[model samples]
Target: MHRQYVVNLSRIREVERRFKGELFLVMDDQEQTMVPVSRRNAPAVRRALQI
Candidate 1:
């Protein structure tokens, strides 16, 4: 079985701050896990996060 988790944008910003504004592929504090961001979704993610 596989498990999935949802993280909020605010958390993402926290991670970005921890990484010094780098959000390409970050490990959020809540999960402390790194998930790969696909090339297709990269732009959308950046736009949503405003990074």
Candidate 2:
């Protein structure tokens, strides 16, 4: 699909939930996912994961 957002998807938390707490995204096609948000660094999560 190769889709991307340029208008700033500020509601990235919703994306985190959609994947059932998957913090990391697959860098390779044959890899597991991640729940990019953490309770300890939730604020950073927003910036690091580009929320």
Candidate 3:
């Protein structure tokens, strides 16, 4: 069996731009994991975050 955990968008603390226009979103949670965003999806992701 598998389980999926969802983090609220409101917990995003920082958005870092990576190489080749990639992005990393830092969530201010207990683990503080960095979620990568593809270059092609950066625009849409930014729009959703309203950054």
Candidate 4:
């Protein structure tokens, strides 16, 4: 499987732009899983997901 950031950019971006503070992803595929990221990576992670 791909790295967490490599896979979900859009969701990351939405979290960056629209939401504030810590981010959490609740994927339908991975229930009860947690994907935590650095604050610095948050923006790029989001942009990549948009692709």
On TM-score, the candidate that comes out on top is 3
Cα lDDT tens digits, model 2, 1-51, are: 012312233333233343544343323223333334444555555566566
Q: Can you give the lDDT of residue 17 in candidate 2?
A: 42
Give candidate 1 regions above 4 Å deviation. 1-5, 13-24
The prediction achieving the highest lDDT against the true structure is: 3
lDDT of each: 0.50, 0.39, 0.73, 0.45
Q: What TM-score fits each model?
A: 0.50, 0.32, 0.71, 0.43
How many clashing pairs per prediction, in order? Answer: 0, 8, 0, 3
Instruction: In angstroms, give how far residue 2 of model 1 lies from its true place.
Output: 14
- Candidate 2's displacement at residue 3, Å, is 30
Candidate 1's error at 42, in angstroms? 0.4
Candidate 3 at residue 5, lDDT? 34
Ranking of all candidate structures by their TM-score, best first? 3, 1, 4, 2
Tens-digit lDDT track for model 3 on 1-51? 001334467888999887777788888988988887766667877898888
> Pairing residues by index, what is the TM-score of model 4?
0.43
lDDT (Cα) of model 1: 0.50
Q: Each prediction's Cα RMSD?
A: 6.3, 9.8, 4.7, 5.7
Q: Could you give me the TM-score of model 1 versus the true structure?
A: 0.50
